[model samples]
Target chain A: MKRARMENELVSKGHVACPGCGAALAMRYVLNVLGPKTIIVLPACCWSVITNRHPECCLEVPVFHTAFETAACVASGVRAALEVKGDNSTNVLAWAGDGGTFDIGLQALSGAAERNDDIIYVCYDNEAYMNTGVQRSSATPWGAWTTTTPATHFKGQEKKNIMEIMAAHRIPYAATASISMPEDLMAKVERARDTRGTRFLHIFCPCPTGWRSSPDLTIELARAAVESRAFPLYEIFDGAKRRLSLDPAPPAPVADYIRPQGRFRHLDSEQIEAIQKRVDEEWLSLLRLIENNPA
Target chain B: MKEVMMGDVAVARGVKLARVEVIAAYPITPQTIIVEELSEICGRGELKARFIKVESEHSALACCMGASMAGARTFTASASQGLLLMHEMLHWSAGARTPIVMANVNRAIAPPWNLWSDQTDSLSQRDTSWIQLYCENNQEVIDTVIQAYRIAETVYLPVMVVLDAFILSHTSEVVDVPEQEDVDRYLPPFKAALTLDTNDPRAFGSISGPMEYQKLKMARHEDMMGAVEVARRADDEFGEVFGRKYGIAEPYRCEDAELILLTSGALGGTAKIAVDALRESGAAVGALRVRLFRPFPADEIAEAIGDAPKVAVIDRNLSVGAGGIFAQELKAALYDRERRPAVFGFTGGYGGGDFTPEVVEKIARRALEMGKPDSPTLWEAIP
Candidate 1:
């Protein structure tokens, strides 16, 4: 797929976002496609702080800074209010971190999906709770080092399959994108906006501060993630129809995605190989789901 | 037209009459019946509303928030652990001023994991900026639900109507479920002052720096405190239409009594009975039922207990290292008053334990004996 570049320069330069902050770029692209008529529902995450507390907003759209776990719920409320006033033209977008989406906000997100609530829920996956000093979240990849999971006792759990969970709800639309793929990401946003019911976009957002990598490497890491099939770009409709949006490009080694970041620095050759096997298994499973359910 | 019903059913009936547009909830003990009845009503097309089946208590509130923000009259019910799970969104709903109304079936929090009655779950959320109303019977539960919407929407604040777990939620009583037409005539469709207006765009939930953060918070606080009057007016209007009035603080037998018992929820009935029994025994004991919790009704409470030698507060919930939650609030209310009654606090009837007349009589006797104020409020019947 040919990735499209963003046109509108919605985000101004000299903002306070850390270099290599995938969430910042994700916001820029999302706003570019969503336009100014969009209302962003943000739960507790780096973006909440990154937006720079009230009076000084980074994005051109309206942002509702909600609690850590109520992003989907708040957005649902915002959408309902808009509908009531015969203002259905505005888009209600819930932008949350992996900790908020995959863990805390899962229940609300699931409920919204089951009801087919008219809203867009975007999960910016930075793996760990970066805003709260790099703590481990369910989205944190296995064998990673966070403040909570010291190098000696790294995270042993696999990153939760959030896309599968959202798919299980049988929502109208669900897709995965990455910060590195602006065109694909914006295209997914446009697709979600066009559809009704619960639409989810899971963006593979890299965090240089939390991942222990150079700020400039964020986009490269995101691209590596997709190329390695570690984070595939795909979409599901009604939990039945699955579409693979991007074919893996030569299937880059798992180490190509993991080695540059400090979070995975402690992994030995065998651990890296183990991660590669797990990624391969997940990729094959997803591929099978797509092939078996071709529309 | 008044028929006997459980407090939970009355709440459901009230929501129906109010023409709630959306109902979202997860089933929890005590609270499950309310949502079940609501769903059945929606399923039968009796109420034109969307009944959302949520996976957890947290989602219930979130779904309701969505519906409420969308300008629908939204509602949900939960108890104890469920209320605890919805803790995060409680602030969101209030901070956003979404005006969602919920019925909290007051149940004890877990660790010991009991499903019986307690107020800790909802009372613990005092700082969440919600307008809270506690009910004494099935009738109040029904009436309060209706009144909550009026107050919530008027102030642009969310409101929680709390009923004791089984004592009120499960028990049957005669309740006059108001007519839908009457409710419609009285409670108009919600017109949110602040909402997502695309034509005239505005920023919400922006980060506030030191310059305006405190002022914004103070404004919210003032609004919350102002809700006390708003709730009273709503109740007044409800009574004018329904012909029954309930004040923020309901005084029962407090006149010509030396000792007064402060109670809330279903225990108010028991306390009233105990007061009658004590009167028969020639002991001057009275009862005071608190209906509105948030805004505390501090002035009314202090005045209601006026000149009584002693006042005993029976709380069905605890506050850990602190005493009962109600007791703590009452103490704070009476802290600066001169010639205040010797307020005594007692924590009892927790986690579905019944508070009978005997228990009330025992607390009254103890309060009469202690005539003078005591620090570190006393526990009622603690082993």
Candidate 2:
């Protein structure tokens, strides 16, 4: 597959985003496709901190920094106002962190999706709430360590199936993308832009600080996420049809994805096996989605 | 033009006259009727607004924020727990300065889940930067809604019009519903200073470091202060067309009275009745009703209390450990006064409990008997 040359010139060079921040890369690719005609609504999260404090901003596009649980609602408002003024071409994007999306902002997001509001809602899932010092979120993967979920008592529940929840709304579009694959991520964003009504994109954004991984391993970890089937690359249209974008010929073990991150260092053989079993279960569920609605 | 109407219905009529473009709401007692009427109007095509049925109070405010940002005049109504659930977004709406308008049917915040009149829910959100106005009757409820939009738009802040649940929300009273043509003429189409226009794409909320955060907060504070005068001007202008007058504080028989009662919401009406009866009985007692709670009319409250021998505050809302919510705010306002009156605080009529004129008279007589300053104030018994 040929990769398109990146054209996110609007993003400033040498900004303060941490090295190997998957969210930063996700923003880069999204801005490349969205161009300068997009307005981003950021709720309280790592992205809010990463964007640098005003009067100096990292992104070229106008950004409205909102409260922790109001990104979707604010974006919805912005989208409506644009349409009223006959400026319907601009893309209104609600960019939030896992905690903002899965917990505090869930009610607002659900309201927007249920109404089929014309806006793009993106959740850059870094597994935990990194900005507030790595507290556990509903999006935190099973058996992960954070300040709130210590290794002695790590997160026991599986990460909430956010994609499935979005699909439940029967929205026009819902997709899972990763920062490792810009082409796939950009393609999903472009598709969302073309479609009307609520569109959701959940990007697997790995946080080196939160995950306790080397900064350089960010892209590799993201790729491991996809290759291990821990975070599969897939899309659902009208919430009914699921299409698998990439099916690896040789699937990597879940250990490949977990071993690099210190957050998952406490998992013993039995615990690892338990996690693997859950991952397998979820992968099978995705496979069923694809098989039931081929293409 | 004056016809009998429920406070909730009057608020709904005001929303229609304002031509609010979007309404997102959920059902809660006291607040349910306002949303229901708005939905009916939307369904009948009497009001061209998108009525979204949301699952929770959080979502209702969230939807309103979205619609407001989209540059549409948006409205929503909630009470008690609903208002509490929308707490996080309340800060967001005000912080973003979306100028969203909300009708808060004042109800007691839950613990035992009682659905009755109280100012606790809206008053608790005092720091959220929302312009809060307490209505004395259905007439003021309608007028305040119109004035809220003008003040909010001028100051670029969200506004909440609070009416007592059951007392005003359910009770029918004579109110002059303004003509739609007059409303349109007075309240112009919402033209947001900042919006999501592709032609002039700009960021709204951005992360601010410690250096810029304080300044941003100060700017919001200044705007809030500006809303005080803005509200007064809006009210004056609204009266010019609608043939009614309102101020931050409405004085009733305060002249030459040795004792005065500071009150809000429908209780003001009851207090008025009590004051009239007391005056007929040759007792020197009057009433002062506070319409605007936030940007608190401190100067006006001071002047209203004047050199009265004693001033009694009646609060229907409790602040838990702090006592009456309004009483606490009132004390703070008069804290530095050179010759402050003996301030008395009374908490009663909570959770939809009625406070009749007899009860008001009783509290007044008790305050007059005490004749001295008291700490933590007095708590009125609901008899």
Candidate 3:
């Protein structure tokens, strides 16, 4: 397929995002895909601080920094105001982290989705509350070690299925993408931008700092998660139709993904085997869903 | 045109006349009718606006704040628990300088689930830095909502127009609704000085350190301090356009009086009647009704009091450990005066209880015999 003209760099160098920050790369891809005619409403997340302080902003588009649990509603409001002003060309994007999407901001996000507000909401899932010193969030995978969930008593529950939760809202569109493939991520963003009401994109991001892995392993871990069926890439349309964006041709062992992260180092062989079984079941479930729905 | 409408409905009329661009609110008792009326207006195409019915008051205010930042005139309404729920965004909106207008029905706080007229709900948020205006009647309710947009847009701060639940909110009265043409001549369309726009690309509400943070706070304070004057001028301009005006702190029959009765909100009307009865009985008494509470209007209040040897202040709200809020703040306002009157603080008329003229008369006669207050709060009977 022939591509459209190249876009300008949106995320400039002045941003405070850390070294090898998958969130930074994801933001760069999303913003560049949406281009300069976009407004970003950021809630309390790593990006809220990583976007830098007053007297300086690194993004090329206008930004509105809102309260902790207000990203979705605020984005809806901005979209409403823009429409009232007779300017429908500018896109409203709500960029939030895992905690903001799955925990504190869940109600507001649900409200916006229920209203089918005209905006794009992207949740960059870093797996934990990495901004506040690696606190355990609902997004944290089971058996992961966080500050709140110590190594002795690791996380005992499953990570929240946020994409499914958003799809349940029956919004116009919802999709899952990973930073491991910039082309796929940007393609999903273009699809989201082309759509109208309440498009949700869940982007899997690897946090080397919080995961206690080497900075160079960020992209590799992101890729391994997809290759190992730990995180699958797919799209849901109108909450009814589903299609697989990427189905790994040859699935790798879950240990190749989990073994590198120190947060999951405490898991024994038995625990790892249980995780692999669960992953296999979930992957099959997703396949059945896509086959049945047939987008 | 003359119309008999409830205070909540009057608020809707004021908003319609002001040509508000966006309204986002949640439904709570007494405050519910404002949004209901607005939704009908929007649906009928009588008012060109967007009405977003949110799930909670927190989201309501958050949505309004965002719209305001996007250069749209915004409004919201809540009461009691709902207002309490919006506490964080109240401070956020003011600090962000969004200039959103909100109406709060003064309902009693819960514990026993009382939902009648009380000032404590709005008063509890005095420190949030939003300009607060308490009204005595439906007329003031409408006028203040219109004037609030003017004052708030001038100061770059949010405004809260408060009216007693069930008293002004549910009750009906005759009001001269201003024509839209007159209101348009008095107040112009909102053009946000600082806003979100992709054309220019600006960042708002970014994190800041002490060096810039404190200076921003000081600027907020200074502009807030200047808001009363802006409000007075707005009222004056409205009077010029529509032939009606109410001062920030209105003095009634206060010339050469030995005793003064000060009150706020709906209780002010009862106090005035009691003052008139006391004067008929050969007592030198006067009435002063304060409208503005956040800036406190200390200079205007002190000027209104003017050499009265005694003051009897009736407050409908409490601070628990502290006494009546208005009386306590009144003392603070008069402390710098060379010959401040001996202020007698009286607390009652809360929790949906009736505050009659007889209660004010009794309090005045009781305070008349005393040189000073025996206690911080003198009671006129409230359980």
**Cα lDDT listed for each candidate:** 0.85, 0.86, 0.90
DockQ of each: 0.48, 0.53, 0.79
lDDT of 1 by residue, A5-73 (tens): 666666666457787799999988888888778877778899888877556666666666777888887
Instruction: Give me the candidate number with maximum DockQ.
Output: 3
**DockQ value of candidate 3:** 0.79
Give the runs in model 1 whose Cα sits over 4 Å from its true position: A1-15, A80-89, A114-116, A142-145, A149-158, A248-286, B111-113, B369-383
Chain A TM value for model 2? 0.98
Local accuracy of candidate 3 as per-residue lDDT tens digits, B1-383: 99999999999999999899989999999798999999999999998888888878999999999899999999999999999999999998899899999999999999889888878899999999999998989999999999999999999999999999988999999999998888888889999997888889988878899989999999999999999889889888988888888899988888888888999988888888998999999888898998999889999989988899999888888878887888888999999888699998888788877778888888889889887886566475643
- Badly placed stretches (over 4 Å) of model 2 are A84-87, A266-281, B375-383
A34 Cα displacement, candidate 1 (Å) = 3.0
lDDT tens digits, residue span B1-383, model 2: 77899999999999998988877888999898998899889899998777777767877787677667668898889998889988988988888788889999988876888888888899899999999999988999999998899988889899999999888899899988888889998999998887655467565666566767788889999888877788888988988988887888988999988889989988999999999999999999999999989888788888877888788889888777887877888888888988678778888788756789998998899888895756555454564
Cα RMSD to the true fold for all candidates: 3.3, 2.4, 1.4
Ranking by DockQ: 3, 2, 1
How far does residue B43 in candidate 2 sit from its true spot (Å)?
2.1
Candidate 1, residue A289: lDDT: 97
Q: What is the lDDT of residue A150 in candidate 3?
A: 94
| Model 3, backbone clash pairs (residues 3+ apart or across chains), number | 0
